[model samples]
Target: MRILTIIAATLGLWIAATGVSHAEATYAPQKVVYHINGTGGENGAGYKPALNNISNHISAVGADNLDLRVVMHGDGLGLLQAAIDDQQLQGIIAGLKNDGVQFLVCKNTLTGRNIDPETDLFDVWPEDIVPSGVAELGKLQAEGFAYIKP
Candidate 1:
């Protein structure tokens, strides 16, 4: 029993010294894409929870080990629009961006909706625009990014 206790303590020490939480070590690096096609109704209600899930996912998997992207098209563009006026949402987005999350906007949505990417959306760049959101989703999936719609 004493020998077992000592071995357990030594294992714990090694884990602590490695600077990796058990959860982080347990999860392999992941390529994930989140789909956003709706505005989640007024005030971007569903957006916050979805963003929160991404935050939680980063926490669990460790940002360095994750390739995460958010593809927003259709009414989903409202996420950026809503963020334009909502500070909390903006902060969440900025935090996610700082953690290396890529936000992809759809050009088709922009042209169809008559929304100006530079002037209307929040913190979106030219490189961030994809020709079609759905196509991007498919491409990402083909590239082995797991699909998630939340």
Candidate 2:
């Protein structure tokens, strides 16, 4: 009877130790997608806030630990326009991209707005443009990406 009790106690301790080790070693990575579609004028008031929000997000999450993507459609394409050309915005976008944040433009909006992506966007690629902005957001959310509209 004493030997059985000792064996049971040893098994309980091993189980408890394994559980603690697993808890310490396991962590879920965060995945986020930000949506921006507001148009900004020459004064740039509308656009500045969105840029700031993106910067804040990157700061909040250690960039290396996050999977981030930004989807732009409608007037939001203006955020990526070549005409705005603010040095701060450029720096932020470049830095974010370096941190693995993808900036995607909506092809439909570009066509409706009559803006040429090749000329209007600073560094957007054809593959980066989605067929529909809102739909893409929905899809990304379903795929386990937390969505933020800013």
Candidate 3:
């Protein structure tokens, strides 16, 4: 029993020292798109939870091992609008973006809603605007990205 305990401790230390752990085995590389079509609630509560979920996802999968996208359209555009004023949301978004998560906005929604991406949205670039949210979602799915609506 004593020898077995010592061997176990040494093996564990060796694994840690070598940076070889179960995390790699536990999480496979993933391509995922999160669909957001509605604002969750008032006071940014609607999208805050969704953002939290996205953060938790990056934490679990490890940013380097994940290819993640957030596609927003319709009422979902409310998220960016809220972020424009909410510093907390902006921080969260910046962190997610730093983690390589892409936030894609729908152009159709912007046009129909008469939202000028330059002023109405938060940190949205021309490159971030998609022709259509739903269509982009379909394209992503067809490209082997797992679709998640939350």
lDDT (10s digit) by residue, model 1, range 1-150? 999999989978988998877767779999999999986678877799999999999999999889999999999999999988889999999999999999999999999999998889899999999999999999999999999998
lDDT for 69 (candidate 1) = 100
Off by over 4 Å in 3: 1-22
Q: Over 4 Å off in model 1, which ranges? A: 1-7
The superposed Cα distance between candidate 2 and the true structure at residue 44, in angstroms, equals 3.0
Model 2 lDDT per residue over 55-146, tens place: 77666655656788899898778777833467676776788788788988887888888978877777787888898888989999999999
TM-score of 2: 0.74
Please estimate how well model 2 matches the true structure, expressed as its whole-model Cα lDDT. 0.77
Q: Sort the candidates on lDDT, descending order.
A: 1, 3, 2
Cα-based lDDT at residue 40, candidate 2: 78
Is candidate 1 or 3 superior in lDDT? 1
Candidate number with the higher TM-score (1 or 3): 1
Q: Return the clash pairs for model 1, or none.
A: none
TM-score: the better of candidates 2 and 3: 3
For candidate 1, give the lDDT of residue 111.
97
User: What residue pairs are clashing in model 2?
Assistant: 37-76
